[model samples]
Target: MEAKSERAERAAQNELLFRAVNEQILQMTERFRAQLSDIDIVCECAVASCVGTIRITAEEFVRIRRETGTFFVLAGHEDTDVEDVVGRRNGYVVVRKQAVAADA
Candidate 1:
């Protein structure tokens, strides 16, 4: 069986992929480049079946990325066993992995 730490690491890695994709999306949008426009990004949840969206501005996204192990997920999608709810905002919440964030 996969260890809890391992599972948490894997989940964080999955969230990282979603973060990368969102970053790419923000970069591609001309409007967001000039102003802080809100965009719908895929939720960075650990669950494979989750298809939730997070509405946040590009500036807010950049602020979230400034911290290591931090990820943005849809409201109520946080995994308390592996992550902690660090911040709450409209439509979503920010989570910080409990540990093993660097593995990703």
Candidate 2:
């Protein structure tokens, strides 16, 4: 019973962290929308932790790359074709950074 309670507490904490980060990303997207009129931005949040994926126009991608110092990894490089519509080339997924202390 104690173990179950502990697990539930951890889940709740993770959920709150996820929500906080998701809101931050939404705010950032809104800012992007206001500055650049050419491209569109879409954000996708993960149910677990601070992980998320964002889709932005290719032009937006370039702008974000220039603005932020964050690093990104290439995904969807398998049998799936990465090149498709706006979400494919122009947009990117935004993942939240997790603190080392939180991992414990």
Q: TM-score winner among the candidates?
A: 1
lDDT of 2 by residue, 18-77 (tens): 445544654566667666544332232222423444444445455544422122212431
> TM-score for all predictions?
0.84, 0.33
Per-residue alpha-carbon lDDT of candidate 1 for residues 6-77, written as tens digits (9 for 90 to 100): 888779778888888788877777455666487778898887667788888878888888888888998889
The candidate 1 region of ten consecutive residues with least summed lDDT is 27-36
Residue 98 miss distance in model 2 (angstroms): 25
lDDT (C-alpha, whole model) for all candidates: 0.83, 0.37
Number of clashes in every candidate structure? 0, 7
lDDT of 2: 0.37
In model 1, the Cα lDDT at residue 89 comes to 90
* Candidate 2 Cα misplacement greater than 4 A, ranges: 34-104
Give residue 28's error in model 2 in angstroms. 1.1
Most accurate candidate by lDDT: 1
> How well does candidate 2 match the true structure, expressed as C-alpha RMSD?
13.3
